[model samples]
Target: MLAALILLSVGIIEIQAGGTPICPTITTPDWGEVSCSNENNVGSRCNLSCQAYFDLVGTTGDAIETSCGFDGMWSTATEFECVPIKCFPEQVSPENGEVICSANNFAQSVCVFFCKEHFDMVGLSAANNAHAICKDDGDGDEIGQWVSSDGSTDFQHPFPPQCQPIRCPTTMEAPLNGQVICSNRDYSGSYCVLFCRDGFKFANRKEKIVFSSCSKEDGHDSVGEWSMPDAPSCRQCTRAEEVQLVALIHESEGDRGQYQVATSMIAKVLTILRRRHGINPTLRVNRYSSSVDASNEVFTTAFTLKSSKREIDAIPYPGKGANTTTALRYMDQRLTGDRSAKIAFIFTNELRDFDAEMEMKARNLVEREVSLFVFTLPQKNRARTWIREQLVKITRDDTRVYALPRMRFTNKYKDEVAAKINDITMTKGCDFLI
Candidate 1:
């Protein structure tokens, strides 16, 4: 009775027990790791993470984690797992080539590479023994890489094979009065384009009207062989009528060498025009100067078509000038009248003004159907920018203008300059002069 009275005074009776807490033992997910806060006990939390190249799914919160609630259960339960990352199939191949993957980019997949028609593979893979492998190497990394067939590693990044264009051998030679340029030295599908020098045309009438390309035949093996039968040739082209040419040479302060070169090249052009094309070409030498009395005079009058070298040598050189404005104005005046299809070649160093007046002169020259080819010689004055911008605006055709670097008086360079001049003239011919 006394014990009962004590229990009643205490309000209730109690019993003690001992064991582990009733917490769920969460299993680790595939390709993922799991860790728990306090062994997943009540009020404890659990966190998950995926291995390399794998991503966690299901939970959208800041972390892949959940807490054990008071109900003795996990607060979050879903199909949370890790997924492997797959690369795009097209990424396996470089441009102009194709790739064949083994299993659509799944783990342990392989890929074989090949080039299209008229192309050949480069590097070790070209020997038909190498391929790309999709392997994890058991290092917890799931990225695959390219490997050689002899168990040798190729590109560190497992890249695709290189496929280069195949072209036939170079059999086309430069025509006598023309030039031939090929896109490739030796392979298939390469092209060779032909171009005739000035006052010249393709020897064949059919070829003169239509330009042809030298190309390799399809399926032709790259054994260093020529597929085209014969190369193109060029001959002296007869003008529809006589064409006249007037040269306005520049004789600046330090351009004595260039002045000499101009005289020599001009003589060559005149001789070629008269002898080859049977045209009576006229030449007028002039200079630029800043002197108050500097006149844009025609130092040599309209000479005979086949002007002698001595005749060209006798022409006096004009003194230096501040700019070529005066000479340009002079050229504009002389380009007038029944000189149909007449071409004017102006050699100058600088442009003093690109004003409205200059534009009108350029327009006048163009109206007379005159082809104005302006040649700018090199100058040491680096601070002064050339008037190329102004010339483009004036002529409205920038292609008709040309610029030359500092004079290199080698025969080769001189010939090249002459060839360029002729090329431009033949391609952009003037009309029949009355």
Candidate 2:
């Protein structure tokens, strides 16, 4: 939109940037047209006006003044050229978006930016719905730059913004005794659904399923995240049934002081369950260790709930490492079908040989309809932390992991533990009965 002027010489010789006066040839700046008025003589004037979209090379004002004198030479002279106005020409539009610009990219043009669906414009450039005005970077070269302008954008093509996938909070975790599935391809309009396993239900009015979707937050133009506050949880089916308790009590030289409590808890769990499962001669108890150095490694004979106390009492101390993979594999061979409600309890200080293989076996045990509970003696270390992580993978349900407040159990806790196990085998709790 801007225009400029240049003063030419009126004389026998045509005016040019560097050429000296010649008899017949004329030279003029390529930036614009030069006017020669009818005669070539002293005092006549030659005029120059820059081409469209080009500004005068140097000096301001409507015109720069100079004249042709009787000496037949240029009176005043300087070197310069006309340049096209623009912001950065190499600019790329935001990904997954398009833009419209005004003025054919010449001076004073503005540009507007728009992103495709499932994407949100990000960065400060999105402040005004993303508009940019053609301008210079504030240096004299005027190579061109787009600057954020008076208000929100729609004005195109300079200082373009970026389009990014929208998002919801990634903080939501799978609930206890249940699983969560989410489809968050671009987070825009994405959703998450929760599923409770068989024999388990949500405590919130006994809901079987729960879910929520992600949406753009009001007043926000970019990626955002939302989370379920105090997230819902899954509780076990409260029903009374026969419980077959299969426990693996780990024994090691340094027991973390769990040898006594682990054994006592098992004996109590069996007693609490004696009324329903003690009579089943097919169900038995045993002590197993993957380490050859461990005592009583083999599980054998008819040891019912009544007779298993002696077996429980004899649990070896300073025995050795507990390889749970072997224990789960051992149980997998014996339990099947719907004859009774089966429960597997594993007691340990910290895990040993508990790897992906062990987790897979534990999951297989759970899928076969067996309730698996892991009792770990509370302590600290990288091993303990690792055990905590692996336990979630094995159980899928963190509720199944029980961390003791102390190395030893009190009579009150022992009874409470027994009662918790007993309660799991009953069917009346979902009805809200005590």
Candidate 3:
């Protein structure tokens, strides 16, 4: 026990003399040497010296000596890194190419090359290796440099890598009121499409490609060429030339049963005119019953009827034959100074009165160049014949009278109705003509 106590006391005294933990392990760096005064314990001093072509960094006290302190730390910063001397070759780049590098010297440092606009790199496996790295000579005695080619022995390859300009198919400028967007500005296989601004519509391409492509050449062609259909024009109609359509919807009690049909027909006509053709026309709806008189304008600049119910609800149906002649007179007054062709679509189930005065009014319509078309849903076969006769008497044209069959409001019937209206409007309306 006395001997053990003596040994422990000696150890304590040795630790107190140092008063710090054991110094960290030290070793000579590659291409360099280290010298020590007292070794790795506390109060030990270490100094670094590099071989011929290397330089030391992070050193102190004449930039070399570093001593372990009582706090178990080096007097200078740890990791006294030694770096190789820098050597740069005549920096060169390929024609039309630029170079970038992380470092100008030392092994593992790399230089990258890139081609200018309209050009692409060639001769190397770009998918795998597109840059050059600094490496050492086989004997580790000579400094190496980045070169253009793997087999080159010079500092840089005598002939640099090539960059070839890319050529694409030719393209025309964008059309009026339209924009063209391309995948590649002028390159083979580039694609482009046309877009027109609001209020203008692309015309004449009902069943043809509107987008263009820089297509690969056929065997007959010398080079790849642009492939495109005849481009369509963005079409817009002038305000004065717009067609004027006035639908005089009959709201007499007798025609109330056909309200759904009339509503559907009017809505479909307006939709085709405004939505499909982009024609904004003045629309005056004459909802007349001799008892309750209402003239509701459904559309002037825009059409707002979304459904058949909305339109029917907007028409007040509490009158008796407010007189089709009266409605025509109203439209005639509206068309006083306007020289544009007008269409007066009259929707009715029966005609209350057909007199000499009505005939004169009808003749006035023809004189004013106002086209009249009559769409009727008569009650009986005899009544249908009479209504047709009356339409001919009023408009003086048998073709202008269309006696609709008594049927439910089905899609097939609606489609047939829409087709009939479309045919008439396209053929008769001046704005629909080319």
Mark the regions of model 1 whose C-alpha exceeds 4 Å error after superposition.
1-240, 290-320, 381-384, 408-434
Query: All candidates' lDDT scores?
Result: 0.56, 0.59, 0.58
Better of 2 and 3 by lDDT: 2
User: Candidate 2: TM-score?
Assistant: 0.39
- The sequence of per-residue lDDT tens digits that candidate 3 reaches over residues 10-92 is 24212333244445556677776777788766889987766654556544222377898765556765465566745356345
Candidate 1, residues 313-401: lDDT per residue as tens digits? Answer: 55566565554555566666665456234567766667765578777777777777666767666666454455687877665677756
Model 1 Cα displacement at 12 (Å)? Answer: 97
Measured with C-alpha atoms, the lDDT of residue 252 in candidate 1 is 56
Candidate closest to the true structure, highest lDDT:
2
**TM-score-superior candidate, 1 or 2:** 2
What number of clashing residue pairs does each candidate have, in the order they appear? 11, 19, 3
Where does model 2 exceed 4 Å of error?
1-47, 51-53, 57-83, 96-99, 103-105, 115-120, 136-142, 150-160, 185-188, 204-207, 218-223, 227-230, 235-434
Instruction: Give the alpha carbon lDDT tens digit for every residue of 154-242 in model 2.
Output: 44533457787767655446678888777863276666787666667777555567876666654445655544523477777655434
